[model samples]
Target: MHAHIALDGPAGTLRVTGAGLPAVELVRAPGTPADAHTPIGTRRAALLTLTVDGAPAVIRPARGRLLRRSYRVDVRVGGHRYRLVPCSYGESRLSRDGRRIGTLESSGDGRVSDAWDAGPTPLDLAVGTALAAAFGTGAAPWWETVGDIVGELVAP
Candidate 1:
């Protein structure tokens, strides 16, 4: 299945629409800082919440390498757990039980698109779209850049 996500910058909301799934609206949790300074492994993490089929789903930062630049988030919906692992550029992989189920691509323009395998249910699609909209096209966190510079200076 395919889905399109549109983000509202001022309202801090994301709306996802697709063929098979009901429209999902994700709102950024209040007081949640932006991911630039709240990368994975940080004390403060980004959070987005949505409802799917009358059940609530939450997407929040998951544990990851302290020095890495990409963002990682754990999604819980419909009694299932999924992980979003973002790579360089604007690509991310969605996995469940260590198996890839979908891919999300962000255009870095308040728009994200996703393609999912047939095995994913509508709830999964909603969660995936929320993840893409929340963390669009990862960028190096400020601390990561500082760490890189420190490492380079210490290298022999």
Candidate 2:
């Protein structure tokens, strides 16, 4: 019950598609604030607020400024904060209050791997997958996250 999400075409705009989720459109058309619009995807509700910090990419030139951005995605749902911090190359650790919850790992072909424990509910899984997209890994399918969560819950 893992999710494998990959980015299609080039960079700049967030467009992703995977198993159980539809194609996610992260930003609005063009000439809009990167964080102005909400992310739209299959089973993409219950996500209260999604904020992004640190450029996930190495160098992103914005507004005449060449900034080195690291992906720091903060997702909030029902007052719980789920943070994704870049731990190393091709890997981001998702945690809550310094405790590990899950991990979003990037593969060689730009696909993102999402895995979590049984503690998180379906809503949590939804937000976590969104966090991956919001950060930069691209959007994963909804069923993948849900399946993983259910599997963990059923595991011994």
Candidate 3:
């Protein structure tokens, strides 16, 4: 099952509420073809591999999601209502343009949840967070004080 949640912070605000699991896999977006022996489709993927090589990780989970070391949250964000969703303690990796998004993780499941106290954030922020989680700075040294993403996800 899918859900709706939001992440609102001083940096920005965003919402991730959608139903149904994305066809993409937890390891990487599905059908992305990441055999270094072969060619992958995106340069961002290569950069992510280079930038996030061997970074430390600290991940927790929202709701009942797994909250353990070496584990991150797997969140799919979107929806017209309640615009933000955070996985409690995973990291985000945005795309080059800062639009497309996806996430890399050590471990965690659908533990993402909305911050009921603060309420939800704007839809744009939700998208941005998802973007960050997917392929933006969260994937780079700028933010990888946290996780390891073996593959790449794209911008929306």
Candidate 4:
């Protein structure tokens, strides 16, 4: 179970590792139509558990090394050819009128890479030319293109 999350810091501690690292384990998609643990496509990558005002977010680590800006693809796993650490698929938020509208992240291994959902249409310039044409990676945002660094804060 172990899904808490409450780190505000005073005693100082915070390591809610990427995408809600609650013991790390959740992989579906034998057919995956959802319900296998929620969160699917449309920026899929689940694990969740981050409250804050209601408490929950208290893990640790990341007092130093936690760079994590790396990007890669090509995944198979189990059957071999594994490289699947696939993540960044973070989509959830939109307020508008209250002001916020926008969010959408989608690195692969979640399988849907028609060249990473094919590009261009203001999704931060097709997620910055689809993360440099699907993972040669690096370099975007010169004057805004590469869809604003893959749409900056991760598209929407």
Candidate 5:
């Protein structure tokens, strides 16, 4: 998949397009936190609406509280759930039930590179590409880390 994100407007939007998979656009919610600064470095997150071929699929967090060395996010499309976690060198691995399916890489620009070793469901590609867009946004505010810790403490 090839992805592009628009960050200059009032809302951050990510669009992904590729062969076989329907085009997807993830629009970040107005109040969703998009970046955070941790003790290690910077991280990013977003609550986004996933749209495939102009049809809405789901609204979910594309990335979660992360440390400098590692990142993880839970994503669900249709009834299938997956996790996108940091692997190495700005790359993220997409897995389902502990089995690897695809890998995503961001160019640090607005572009993203993605590949799947096997056939992937559309929702899978949509969520994975959206998460990659969130990662491309860089970091959140340093104070956001405080909220992250507090959120983690209260979350069950």
Candidate 6:
């Protein structure tokens, strides 16, 4: 079986709705101060927090190298860690333990589709969808942009 959910509205006031689940509205939390010593291009340089349902969840750039053109972010909720990686054409891959469990597509009306057996719970789906919407495709981190600029400058 497959489950589908729709995400609507902007980042601060996004709404998530789907079958068999209550509609949830995610509110973007205020920006947290970044560590003064953490340099740009590091994971701690950029962070986002959202109020999922009623609980607060922090979203941070995941460590490690970038996946081609995609950027990754990590979030923990209900003691479960989830990663959201934005793919080409406005689709974000939602995974846990390196296994893809769901996908969030941002084309037209935003939607999240997942395999029922391997996918996250409805609450998780909502959280993942919200995170994907907040950090959609084509939004590269500052570090990646800096690297691109340096690469172009060095190329023959």
Ranked by lDDT, the better of candidates 1 and 3 is: 1
Each model's lDDT comes to 0.63, 0.44, 0.28, 0.25, 0.58, 0.53
What TM-score should be assigned to candidate 1? Answer: 0.66
TM-score for every candidate vs. truth? 0.66, 0.44, 0.22, 0.17, 0.58, 0.54
| Candidate 6: tens digits of C-alpha lDDT, residues 118-137 | 64677666766665554453
- Candidate 5 vs. true structure, TM-score: 0.58
In candidate 3, residue 43 scores what lDDT?
22
Alpha carbon lDDT at 133, candidate 1:
68
Residue lDDT tens for model 2, 71-135: 45554445566666655545667776557888776442434567776555544454455456544
Pairs with steric clashes in candidate 2: 55-69
Model 3 residue 80 lDDT score:
21
Query: Candidate 1 residues 2-59, lDDT tens each?
Result: 7677776444567777888867776666654444433111322344566665567766
Question: What residue runs in model 6 are displaced by over 4 Å at the alpha carbon?
Answer: 1-11, 22-47, 62-70, 87-89, 107-120, 138-156
- Please rank every candidate by TM-score, starting with the best: 1, 5, 6, 2, 3, 4
lDDT of 4: 0.25
**Model 4 TM-score (2 dp):** 0.17
Cα deviation of 111, candidate 5, in Å: 1.7
Among these predictions, the greatest lDDT belongs to 1
Per-residue lDDT for 38 in model 1?
Answer: 30
Give per-residue lDDT, candidate 5, residue 3: 39
Clashes counted in candidate 4 amount to 13
Error of 3 at 122 (Å): 3.8
* Superior candidate under lDDT, 1 versus 5: 1
Candidate 3, which segments miss by more than 4 Å at Cα? Answer: 1-31, 34-108, 114-117, 128-156
